[model samples]
Target: MRILQQMNAFCVMTLIAFSISASVQAESPAPVQAAKKALAVGQTAKDFQLLSVGGELSGEVKLSDVNADGKVVVVVLRGFPGKQCPACSAQVGDFVKNASKFAAKNAKVLLVYPGPKSQLDQRADEFLQGTKLPAPLTFLLDPGYTFTNAYGLRWDAPRETAYPTTLVLDESGKIQFVKISETHRGRSSAAEVLEAL
Candidate 1:
């Protein structure tokens, strides 16, 4: 009878251990799909279509279509990582400050905002409250990091969205210039992108 009791206790302990392991696994966050390599210059850029926050694209924008006529400056912003990013605003201001230059070069700018699907639009609207996007610039929304993951720019860290990437693509969709910042600062400037064009 003691051996039988010991066997039953062993079975109960095994079940408890299994249950704990399963619970821990369930609570752990899923692994993020890390980029094999950052998108480099001279490589062809992947085309994507995402909802537009404000642009001449009629509430939707496609990369290829935007770059069809001229070169495109793709800016990936850290969208609502709990609050508005001042660096992003400054970078955007730099781009907007040079709007005329980009237009003169026939280069259209597409700002990519990446964040959660819930309240993304509202957050984007808040981000653009005071600033105005000129005709040469468009705001694209990246819900659930779809565009961010596809482009291999997902930060996937605590209080992070994208890696603050900037890529200038030619009319043929070939990347001419690419700058990816691992941190909040070191964003691409308007003059640099204009020179790339």
Candidate 2:
């Protein structure tokens, strides 16, 4: 009877551990098939200027400004809360960890979140809090998806969200690397973008 009880205790502990691991892995949920159509390498990224949450001044920032003196990593995020998007947040967090690495390689990181202009500033501010993305990172609002439409990241699938993708631009503002998620889950990691640089 003593041996049986010990085995039961061990099984319970094992189950608890597995449960915790799964929760940690869910920091970002992956996107489905429709968000995938990524751009090709060597493509010249279109220039875009967006209004930021820092306060409304229309077109205050240009894509060229972010990628100007170094390489730039453009991250597309699910705009607002139709539902909480764990995957988009996760991908941004992954790149946040490597902000310095990109800096060391003379690169910039741009985090773009698109949604309707209504409540966009509030939503973007909340999303950016505690992300640890410093000066080199530019957080932009694609209000009305002005930038999203230009980039072709609009996912019109039934009940689907925006395209979750990543682009690496060289110093001259030309795309050197591109990662279009086949589903929302498959974003390019910090290591992958670094390797391309």
Candidate 3:
């Protein structure tokens, strides 16, 4: 009888321990993701291929292909982070207006729009509704921030996508100028980029 009682006690303790373990697991916080390094000037920018969102072309655009023609201006926009960013719209508009100037300098502008995989294409299309990107400028979609994270520009925060960034890559793919803005403002102007080229 005593042995049976001890066995019962042991079973109860095991059940309690299991219950506590499960509860602890259920209450545990998620693991934090490691931070990524930011891309800098003087470094050769990694080549990437992203689908063109709104442009004359309708397929994948390779960085190397664009750079082969001339210098490349890579603009990273804060994609639809819960809502349309007015600053992004303004920056894009400015670039569009300066399309001719960029062309004159033999520089191709690549605007990267990053967001969640779901409805990313639709959101990007919406962004380009009234704006017409000329031949000198190309709009690219970054589904799930594949290229953004790869370039260390992901702004991983609440209602945030990628940090507004501008990079000037020489014909040889070496980064000659780079500006990364953590806030919504502080964007590089087209004139500044034009001078960089």
Candidate 4:
């Protein structure tokens, strides 16, 4: 009888151990390396259509449509991350300040604002309250990190959003230049982007 009881207890313990392991696996997300490969310079850029929550281009913006027009595209922005990011503001400001220069090169700049799906539009609108986007430079919404994940730029950390990413795509949707900042401090400057163009 004692041996029988010991066997049952061992079975229970094994079940408990399996349950704990399963719970841990369920709670942990896949490592960043497991994500889709990020786009590289010279690769054909993936086309995405995200909503224009705010800015000069306030509607659905399609990347393919822009590429078809023989225009270069510059996409780089840290989407809303529970609040306005100062670095993002500065990066976007630089682009907005150079909007005329981008237009002169027939380039369209798309600044992506990514965040959770809940209240995303409201947050995007709030983020744009004080800024003005000129022609050929627009703000886009990446609700629930859809675009961020698709582009392999989701930061996926506590209080973090997408990685600060800059891509310059040629008229054929090929990436002419790309910069994926490992940290918030290395964002590509407007001048560098123009030079890439």
Tens-digit lDDT string for candidate 4 (1-197): 99999999999999999999999766524433333244766788778888875565778988898678766655556666666788888888888889899988988888888888988878777778866678888788888888887777788888788778788888888888877776677889899999999
For each candidate in turn, the TM-score is 0.80, 0.73, 0.80, 0.78
lDDT for each residue of candidate 3 in 1-197, tens digit (9 for 90 to 100): 99999999999999999999999776512211212133566788899999996754458999998899889999999999998999999999999888999989988899999999999988887888867789789999999899988887778789999888899999999999988775799999999999999
Residue 197 shift from truth in candidate 4, angstroms: 0.3
After TM-score superposition, what is the CA distance of residue 156 in candidate 4 from its true location, in Å? 0.7
The residue-level lDDT of candidate 1 at 52 comes to 80
Which ten-residue region of model 3 has the weakest summed lDDT? 28-37
lDDT (CA) per prediction? 0.86, 0.73, 0.86, 0.78
Comparing 2 and 4 on lDDT, the stronger one = 4
Candidate 2 lDDT tens digits, 85-189: 778778777776776787788777777888877888877877777454555566788888788777877665654546777888888877788877646677788
Worst 10 residues of 4 by lDDT: 28-37
* Candidate 3: residue 185 lDDT (0-100): 94
Model 2: lowest-lDDT 10 consecutive positions: 28-37
* Ranked by lDDT, top first: 3, 1, 4, 2
Shift of residue 113 alpha carbon in model 3, Å:
0.2
